[model samples]
Target: MQRQTTIKKDVSYRGIGLHSGREVSMRLLPAPADTGIVFVRTDAGGRQIHARAANVTSTLRATTVEENGVKVFTIEHLMSALHAHRIDNVCVELNAEEPPVADGSSLAYFDLIESAGIEELRSERHEIVIDRVCRIDDEATGRFVMALPYDGFRVSFISLNPHKLIGTQYEDFHIDAQTYRREIAPARTIAYEKEIDQLREMGLGLGGSLENVIVYNDEGWINPLHFADELVRHKILDVIGDLRLAGIIRGHVIAAASGHALNTALAKQIAASLG
Candidate 1:
């Protein structure tokens, strides 16, 4: 068992959202033990929404949590950072519905949290131990995520893409804050050139650009690859963020072709089972 943790002081940042294209500002404040991570919407008259699986309302292209019609989207990156940092409680105050894209990776958020400094709380974390095999699969897409009993946290992922340039990528990660920051935090979000128009039509990817997003096409990658397996690593990053909604779980997760939807599905299942 480990003590819960929150930042020692308030830290703030401002940028634009990838999907919403809105200018937003956010602050991270320390919270008491067992508060978990809460999203406080300052623009919504100080509405509070807990970051948990039960509150998840959407996973279209990004993980979104909602309560009483108040929604927060594109939280995976920041949540990924929090998960990696093992932060158990914090009040995230945001002036917009979504956080900034932040170079299309978790690096910025990780740095912001580092600046705030983590403080251990008195109470131990309410850990949800995965004692048996738990699995969720999307048959049609061949997407699946599973968790098995393990002494510590780990993630093994496989990313599959129809494109020849990005056919299949695999990576097994033993997660730690240092490893996550160095190996996973810099891996940027990726999109194909072919899907840009479609995404825009769906009112998504409005703030994505060559600067923050790694755009690829059949011709080739428009940007250089940070790691040939960057996509799969980012997918693992998403898994960590999404599964953390179930609280701390002692498990080794194995996933393939999984996305926000499937990740949150597994989170919901684990959370429900624990309750």
Candidate 2:
């Protein structure tokens, strides 16, 4: 069995929320084994929320957790980064209601997590291995997901758009701490200008600007730092956060046209079967 690990030091960053548009600061601190993933709201008298899919109460625009009406928002990217890296135990202390959207990707968190260094604990690592093929479907949105057997955790994703710029993208990858950091961590959050305007009308994406996220125009990327394969890479990052809802899915996962809602539904179903 593998051992648990905690960071050797504290690491911090600052940025705005993609939706809320509010500036936030967060710190990653090492914690003892079995701590799971905890989010501490340093802004609200230290309210702590555990990173369990079952605790998810809101996923309207982003993943959110609420305890006694105190909520933490836009947590998927950071959660994905942590789970992808296999850093199972850590205390995420935040000075706001949401984590900073640094560059709108997991890269910042990846760097902080790496800088802290990993120290293993004596306890054996635990994961909810997938023994059966489980799936979830959203008929209204036509988004679907499935988790199947594999030697290790992996993801296959496909988007349903046909535009030359963002059309029919898919990628499959094996997930390990090192591989995720180098391969997927740099993939930034993205959206179309029309969608951005709509979200902004609803008072969302306040933290979203050209600096943090990659914006797509009618013809192509509006951001200067465009990658040929960024679409697929970003999808993989989303899959990481979605599967995290499984509370530890231990096998390979294959999914297509899926989003955060479907991912969490699959997690809830798989978690239910665990009993």
Candidate 3:
């Protein structure tokens, strides 16, 4: 049987939160088997929020989970890292309302887990295997997310944008720890030049910069690209992180222009189908 696993020791990091723009410190600690991924807000008197689709309250620019009036922001990247590593149980303690946006990608968190090492638990791990095709769509935007039966976790995404620099980009990943670290983890968040001011007016993306966030304009890209099709790869990365809330999914996720809303909705759908 596949055993649940978590970090072997404590590890910590601090950085700027993408939306809140405040410094947030997080500590990853080993948890008892079957604990799943749990987040506790140290600043909010130890209010705990279980990382699950049902707890998600917002999917604006980032994924937000709330419990007992406490909200945690921008969790997808770290969650994706945990999923890639097959970490089934861990206690994440945060000093603020959000986890830091280190490098605006999962690479930093992945490295942190690597440094801490993984420990297998005696408890058996449970997987939500897709037996049939399931789909969710954003009718207005024509974006959709779906899952199909596969032997391993895989994600195929097609990023559709109207901009001249980024029109249509597509990529699929057979997700594994190594593939994630090398391909998806390093792909940073994307921001259009025109959206910065609007995002600021809404009090979002305050910590975003050319360094952590890749900016593009009508003229051209303001920053360098890691891969020619990095945008589509990052979309796949987000899907991995968001769907992870349901547990280790043993299937293939196929998507097009799907963001947080469709991602979490599919997660909830898959969770509900589990017996």
- Estimate candidate 3's alpha-carbon lDDT, on a 0 to 1 scale: 0.92
Worst 10 residues of 2 by lDDT: 224-233
Stretches of candidate 2 off by over 4 Å are none
Per-residue CA lDDT of model 3 for 1-275, tens digit only, reads: 89889899999999989988898899999999988999999999998999999999999989999998898979999999999999999999999988999888899999999999999889889978999987998888889999999999889899999888889999988999999999999999999989999999999998888778999888998888998888888888899999998889999999999999999999999988862
Clashing pairs in 1: none
- Enumerate residue pairs that collide in model 3: none
In candidate 1, what are the lDDT values of residues 1-275, reduced to their tens digit?
58889999999999999999999999999999978899999999999989999999999999999986699999999999999998999999999999989899999999999999999888988888899888999999788999998888899999888899889999998898999998999999999999999999999999999888999988999999888888888898899999989987778999999999999999999999973
Error of 2 at 59 (Å): 1.8
Query: How do the predictions measure up, each by TM-score?
Result: 0.98, 0.94, 0.98
The lDDT per prediction is 0.92, 0.80, 0.92
RMSD of each candidate relative to the true structure:
0.9, 1.6, 0.9
Predicted structure 2, TM vs. truth:
0.94
Model 2 agreement with the true structure over 1-275: per-residue lDDT tens digits: 87877778888888787787787888898899888888998888888888777888877767887775578878888888878777878898888888988898888887888888888888877777888998998888778888887778888888778677778877878888878887788888888887887888888888888888888888878886545678678777877886676566677777777777888788777778851
